[model samples]
Target chain A: AQSVTQPDIHITVSEGASLELRCNYSYGATPYLFWYVQSPGQGLQLLLKYFSGDTLVQGIKGFEAEFKRSQSSFNLRKPSVHWSDAAEYFCAVGPLRAGNMLTFGGGTRLMVKP
Target chain B: DTAVSQTPKYLVTQMGNDKSIKCEQNLGHDTMYWYKQDSKKFLKIMFSYNNKELIINETVPNRFSPKSPDKAHLNLHINSLELGDSAVYFCASSQSNEQFFGPGTRLTVL
Candidate 1:
């Protein structure tokens, strides 16, 4: 079965500290990976996606993810954390041509201490 | 304008009743989808419509039916709702690989 896994359910970081959220996927073929952020009471917003080429993918809100095919991981990273960056982050995997119905991870909640 | 939108931000209904949630997208995308987020916060795809044609239908109960009047709208109707049906339903639209999601409708069945 195709699935995305976020090993960390919650993480706390101080404001201005660097942050990283781990994501791993299980799939048969080359995966199309995505990172989405969901604020409280809000919908899921796409941060970045990795389709093909360039293993390093840049996303909105100063977020970036690197697709490591050998390890089956696409971890989200940021050099600095802000108070406003506190939210739930989900990693997803989908096929390219398939209507792109995403298989999302359980999500990682980030708490920023100001 | 909103890219994807769902009516009834919150729906509170009793079990054994019927309800429908409407979703519309103004992005002129060819594909539309419905997803359900359970109490545990696991999101799963329920249905997908592309250009008024059913493209993907996950393993969901038949009591839940999705109807797409046109390419821009897809509505979900639940018959004989149950307590387990209480969850957040999200509608999304997509052109290629990127999907734009709506604000989501929270359904509470008591």
Candidate 2:
């Protein structure tokens, strides 16, 4: 079965500091990877997605993710974190079949410290 | 306007109750999906309908049924709901590539 793994359960970073969230997926083919963020009492919003072509993909809210096939990882990175960036982040791998449903990782909670 | 919307944002009911949650997408997309988010925030796909055809049906229970009236609406109906059915339900739509999600409906069983 295909699965997505978010190694970090929770991460705390000071405001304006650089941040990185690690994600690894287990799948046979080159998978469609995505990063989604959910604020408290809000829906999941797409951060970025990687399908093909460039390994580095940019997304909304100044977030980006790099799809590394060799490492089987798609890690999200932001140069500077803001207080508003505190939320739960999820890494998902889209099934390649026709339906193409997403297999999400156990989310990672981000804590922004002032 | 909300791209994708699900009615009854919060539902509290007893076990064995029958209930339905409605979903509508105004994004002009032909595909819609239902996903369940557990207490641990782990999301799993339940059902998907594209252009009024049932497409993806995960290992969901038979008690749960999805009805898509047209291309833009897909509703979820649960019969004799169990305790395990308590979770946040999300409605989503997709066009050529990207998928759009709605504010989830949180269901609690007492």
Candidate 1 backbone collisions, by pair: none
Q: Kindly list the per-residue Cα lDDT of model 1 for residues A1-114, writing each as its tens digit.
A: 899999999999999999999999999999889999999889999999999999999999999999999999999999999999999999999886857688899999999998
| Top of the candidates by DockQ | 1
Over 4 Å off, model 2: none
Residue A13 accuracy (lDDT) in model 2: 100
Question: Whole-model lDDT for model 2 versus the true structure?
Answer: 0.93
Q: Candidate 2 — which pairs collide?
A: none
Calculate DockQ per candidate and list them: 0.73, 0.63
What is the lDDT, from 0 to 100, of the residue A63 in candidate 2?
94
Question: Going through the candidates in order, what fraction of the true interface contacts does each contain?
Answer: 0.62, 0.52
**Local distance difference test, each candidate:** 0.94, 0.93
Cα lDDT of model 2 by residue, A39-104, tens digit: 998899999998899999999989999999999999999999999999999999986554468889
Query: Estimated TM-score per prediction?
Result: 0.97, 0.96
